[model samples]
Target: MADKAVDALSENEARDELARLSDLLARANRAYHAEDAPDISDADYDRLKRRNAEIEARFAHLKRQDSPSEQVGAAPAEGFSKVRHAVRMMSLSNAFDDEDIDDFDASIRRYLGLSDSDPLRYTGEPKIDGLSLSLRYEHGRLIQAATRGDGSEGENVTANARTIADIPDTLSGAPEVLEVRGEVYMSHADFADLNARQSARGGKTFANPRNAAAGSLRQLDANITRDRPLRFFAYSWGELTAPLAETQVQAIARLKDLGFQTNPLTSLCDGPEQMLAHYRQIEKQRATLGYDIDGVVYKVNDLGFQARLGFRSTTPRWAIAHKFPAELAWTRLESIDIQVGRTGALSPVARLTPVTVGGVVVSNATLHNEDYIAGRDSEGNEIREGKDIRVGDWVQVYRAGDVIPKVADVDLGKRPKDAKPFEFPTTCPECGSDAIREEGDAVRRCSGGMICPAQAIEKLKHLVSRAAFDIEGLGAKQVEQFYTDGWVKEPADIFDLKEKFGSGIQQLKNREGWGEKSANNLFDAIDERRSIALGRVIFALGIRHVGESASNLLARHYGTWSVFESAMLEAAPMEGPAWDDLLSIDGVGKVMAQSLVSAMNQEAERASIDRLVAHLNIQEAERPATDGSPVAGKTVVFTGTLEKMSRAEAKARAESLGAKVSGSVSKKTDIVVAGPGAGSKEKKAQELGLTVLDEDGWLELIGG
Candidate 1:
């Protein structure tokens, strides 16, 4: 039987769908925002979010705390210092078609209690397809710049922002305290040039202009950003000490006057018809535009009206992004290939007959997973009307500004008579190890561990990735070559390259791609990274769930490599004070902790880590400077209802003061703030003889 529509779904079905959407959207946000790599197309992501919203609207009680409707973006990536936005940076809700646009206008009018004849104007501006940046100016001088990370906090990129020519370092006649919010993008010509240069130098190339812009702006080194041709378009404001103008269009004009690059095509539309007409005009000119714009954003023209309309949890009600439709093409599925990631995930790729989608020729598209190919989602809901994909079948491919194309639908009428359902592999394709799909997991993973060449090579590549060791001239290609040639099998083998192959009959200089100068440069780069920070070292290990941010959190919590190593070794059995302490670190969950422990306690992995450590000097993790703050370096736990503030507000405040907010109570917990309805956690805190405070007490302690 076909699944019911979202409105017709039962309470249980709605709850299950909500859970599935939440997980998928969370992964999508992390890939797009934190990693600068989008796993799904914009259209598919928007569709899932729309379905999630419809279900939530029908069954409000089934709405999850971590609903897609409530999240803005992923948490900020590691390596850069974080900045908390004075005013939250909100995302815009999307409108796919003309009907959605009409409904949007009508809903705004209804909410404001206005008639069709009411003079409600809107400002339509191109929505730049790039990274969102917030530039803060104090006394007409740029003081800080940050990426829009998780809405509330962002990564500090002031140095990189200073290098962009379009972003003025000093603005004349600007507000004393102004935060200009805009999009940082790369022009078409610049993007092509950058890719050419990257390809020539054997460096990683970007998939699109947006990724190029995001990667360039988020660089750890400012000089790299300075060389990249990045542009900015100021379309909004945040935390202004004084209003720029009474209306949106006037405010944009004022921004342009203040030496900011405001979008030239921004116009004031009298009504929905005019707004949509302007959208169509912009769409027609999209091909000629020098930069990339995914859509047009429409906002209420009157500043007062916008304030009255107010904001939702993650988006503003006054604005919506009228997105362009995804480009689609029909192609034949030539074959299905399984590729293993560093984490051993068996991702399926559909090799397709060459076809043009959105002006780009695509020969491969993402199958997502076996379940996706089987025409069902993780919750067993049918997708593409339960049409299973097969080799040699005609498929509809879609491209929505994504790096990879996606198989949107399969045409059963064109299916070949001999077509057969794809059988997912039961063993690793590279190492022949048993591949297992654990309960609740969509992708199957290889059990070969270090022995699997695919996983091993990918892990080695990840060890030297930009966010990890970041060795110059040692990218994915070089890592793969070294691994295949038996020159490097593990992290420790990399350090031994200079000593073992520096001067011998089989020398690095004798390699096909290496000269004396280049070989020495590689050695120097490897040597320079011998004394890396603890966070980078942890990230380079390539633990299953320990990403850059999680690695940094672990490094900060443990302080030193020896301490972290010892704790993980002790926590391997999954019980005891060490395990409890590991679990007590903020953002460290049972799954992450288990992964860390498994990697650290496994005999072969431990030996490899020991060998790697023997050849390097690891620095202690830097602690945030809190000076005289009472909660600095303390671990706090909040339980029950907080009357003074929301739980999120309390956690943010605590973290700002250099405190860790753990989700659970343990003996290592420094304090527990209890409120009405506090039960087990309160009792546990008392039992452990930890400091217990009420909501008022917490406020008093924090100097409210």
Candidate 2:
């Protein structure tokens, strides 16, 4: 997993995580429900479940219909006869962050057609980390008890449940026929004693309280369950013959009066803020609560509203489970690997022995940087208890809510005899470039720029991006393939593709995916961009901090590539007037100028640029439209149907003449270029009273 938190997942990361979670959860379900053999512990399972919920919360649009969020426990373990529940014992949807809780409340109001000012009370209760059970009491007497197997049918644990003192055998002053639904759990103290007894008797010991409760309750022999410390908490009624109370809070009180054990923390909450504050309060008390609780469950207190909200396949829309953060576990660090990024930064990743933490099988964790591995931060503060991570060392991995697995601590006692301190590489692993760290920088970067194979591939990809060179038929995939085959290594190689392959001796047409026509078309496309704007050329270089705006500043300030190149070369050695001129440009910073000067001063790099310059006619950047005739140095927005030229043609024409083409109309907009069916932008421009021009008006003003 990446070291980023769930909130930081990129689109690709989110999509990949969705697929990984789907496959993992599916396998876990098959192992636990279908085979009656759990491959992961209960705490681990809960961790995975919470992680999926948080990921889904952040990326709701990416949620799959067959998601684990819609699934309860695996289909009643295929053993004892299944007891179909009268009322579906559904699972609760989760709320990972405070925003989710607010969204839930807002959704309830929107669905009920209630305004924000309207009060909607909810009952907040502990989400016990245990197995769900449904106890049916007929005519004020307990008739049967079952597990919440698949939410529809469950394994009959009536005999086993009867051994728990918390579960009442009979009920007085209760509904004639009522099915009480709650959790079967083991307290911390009791669980510890039970594990001790099991160890003394040479029996299997559980990993946690939840596992012990589940294993004890699922026993075929009631005598075996009687010996284990099992407890129950009645929270809600599944199938009631008559009304227990008008509100959820009253019902919980009634369940308690009927001699059923209920969670004492269950209270009516006013709103999302109150619920979240209570959740934090519960979390603070979790360690000393005796019984384990994974999260806090909130249900609409009003019975009528709850009925109206009802269920959605497996969970009620009226209730949600706000889960705690994931747990940490110790695992062996098998090895450490370095992954080079597009920016030529070498990132260290720890290769683990496929240990499961919190439910997800993690094979990798981020070592952050060389400092993190050496047990210190960039600021030289002690980290991981001043223990440097080494291969074959036992390390504590914490998932928390981060999508990226983090190395929380190191277990020096479990450190292997052969373990050695990792030596961080000082050279570019890919191209053997001199990797150096500047003062006050956390990471050491390769000084190779675009010469390094890794940096060249990344720059090539960026060179064809919309804001840069944007060469047709030379996308990311084609660039990577050509670079791998030695046909292309730098941005200039793109312009040389035709001459090298035009000969019949080594034709590009012979390539697997290329033909004569396609190859010719690619060459034609390359020829079309021989005369490129100076700003685009600078941006295409991918100099560290020289972005589109910075490149434009340099291009406009210098006017031509030769002037900019001469100034950068002259300023490279020291902080002189030539460097001051670069820093004087608007949007140009000292760091950006430093990077530009550094790149232009490299001997190997200058040679490569000279070769590219020989192949093309570099255009001088135009003076701002503000200082010239119309639309010069001014922000121009284009919208609607253009009859004279395509949108791309209009944007190119405007940018060529020093007019900034903006996507949206704002107060800074100098002019609005509207077409046949102009919308909000044109209207906003008109309201702002900025110069509004039609297609023909714009064409006339620009002399197009």
Candidate 3:
């Protein structure tokens, strides 16, 4: 597949290639954009996308509906409230080399019906390798900040954005309404310092500055974001009440004047040659820029020209991102090692002969999964030309603004004579439990559950995490020590620590690094957390696929732990009213429901939960303050197309008014807002005798 050119491919091959490309690109998007962790290099991703586009061009009729070419970024990640952008945030077209730049210029000229000699000024700015953010301001005050999700909607991160020193809380002399778009970035020095601190504290360190910036900005807690040094550079606008300027350069100047940071290297270029020159200049200074930038962006100078050029489905025709070449080097694959995660995922790591990539020394790289090592995708499609990797083989390691290097290509010709295809282990490397690869799952997982030491230790760490019990003086290090000493093996064991090790022969104060004061403090902290909120309690359990937001949703829906536990026990059979009710919660899916039920029904797990419960007081989830709103505490369902606002916007508004927004209509549904084309849900609501309202009625009732 790698040897075959797009022009030489048959229709069937092209179709298969398209499918492979779509899946790879989609996963890459989620990894990079949503998770802030990229498994593939930018150069490799670009090559796959280019190949997909070329194949689609050759076989237009074979283009899949879920083509990567038609998509923007991945959908907004869960746990955060969603924000619908007033003006869609579009991505830019890419230009790889001088020829591509020339083609881009030519295309713009052709679209404008102008000759090559005609005057067309462009603005070139360094494309910062960071997260895209949109800040909405009203009446000169910053109101909301959101990430660039799927172009249409994004995650609301207003509190986190407010903590960045580079962003102004209130803009003076700005438009009545303005939506400033920029890149949230971390400087190399700051990123290095932050990583150093994280490593010292036994916390997770990011691989690169871009990931650090994104991870920081998207933190659930703003105080954590405030601690991380983040910066922003405004380069564009989204929604505006009035025009800022007639040209792009003037608009940027106005933004800077309004107290927003703008990239200083931005310059006006008369044509493609100047743009290329600026790009080369930026490339030359990239190493010394103090910040990470992957490319240079060229945009039409005149706002009028931009308006005339408009946009493609997901990209703007008036702008292009000319990416820099990836840094790559040859390295030897010394060995393959499997590491078991808390979720029982057997992740493969490639121990490499030490080499340098992108000015960083690399001794390791991510092998992604067993399928990737075997040169195949999840669907058995060929990858890396179906060349499997083996120990003692020469591999091409690539680093593209990622902390960890990746083996992009293997030199099969340079393979060692005795090298053999690596066999992935069929059992957990840590606990000797059988590893199973479920249907549709890319990675094989250990089925040992709580019996596995790795899973048990990680779950114990999670139980005391900041979002869970958050016991002071008890962190990952303490958890690991306690687990290794056999003082704490499960959640219930944590509660018995005082009685077991507080005095006599097994005294905790006598342990290394533990003075009497510190030991007392730790015990006090554990005791203080004996009573916890229901959401935190649920999250602390570390159920598969159930996150903080889902925990909260379940807590709100069930109200009490006894009721929730009883319901889960009833739903263990996986049917009837209890199961239906569990599935009725907006975000609860079948997989999560099953996981919850199984955890509750399992003998050992249930006994451990009950034991832990006997020692603690769990508070009911707090309801949102109604603030005199009419729909407060009511359950509302919005079905079909919403005319006044997007579904995300409507849901956000309803939630803000203290109304619960459910995806399905059930007996608990208090109101149903049905728009045009509303069918099943509307009819179901009518059948259930639930109050139904049209779009206009919904708007009127909410006083929107």
Best by TM-score: 1
lDDT measured at residue 372 in model 2 versus the true structure, 0 to 100: 72
Which candidate achieves the best lDDT against the true structure? 1
TM-score of each: 0.71, 0.49, 0.66
Task: List where candidate 1 sits over 4 angstroms from the true fold.
Answer: 1-40, 45-124, 130-232, 236-251, 264-292, 296-328, 357-361, 377-385, 503-506, 510-513, 686-689
Candidate that beats the other on TM-score, 1 or 3, i.e. the better one: 1
Q: After aligning candidate 1 to the native by TM-score, how far in Å is the CA of 24 from where it should be?
A: 9.1
For candidate 3, lDDT tens digit of each residue in 463-507? Answer: 986557878788778899999999899999988998897462247
**lDDT tens readout by residue for model 2, 516-575:** 777877788788889899988887776655555567767876789889888988898758
Q: Candidate 2 at residue 230, lDDT?
A: 89
Score candidate 3 by TM-score against the native.
Answer: 0.66
For candidate 2, give the lDDT: 0.76
The TM-score measured for candidate 1 stands at: 0.71
Q: lDDT at 392 for candidate 2?
A: 93
Residue 209 Cα positional deviation in candidate 2, in Å, after optimal superposition: 1.3
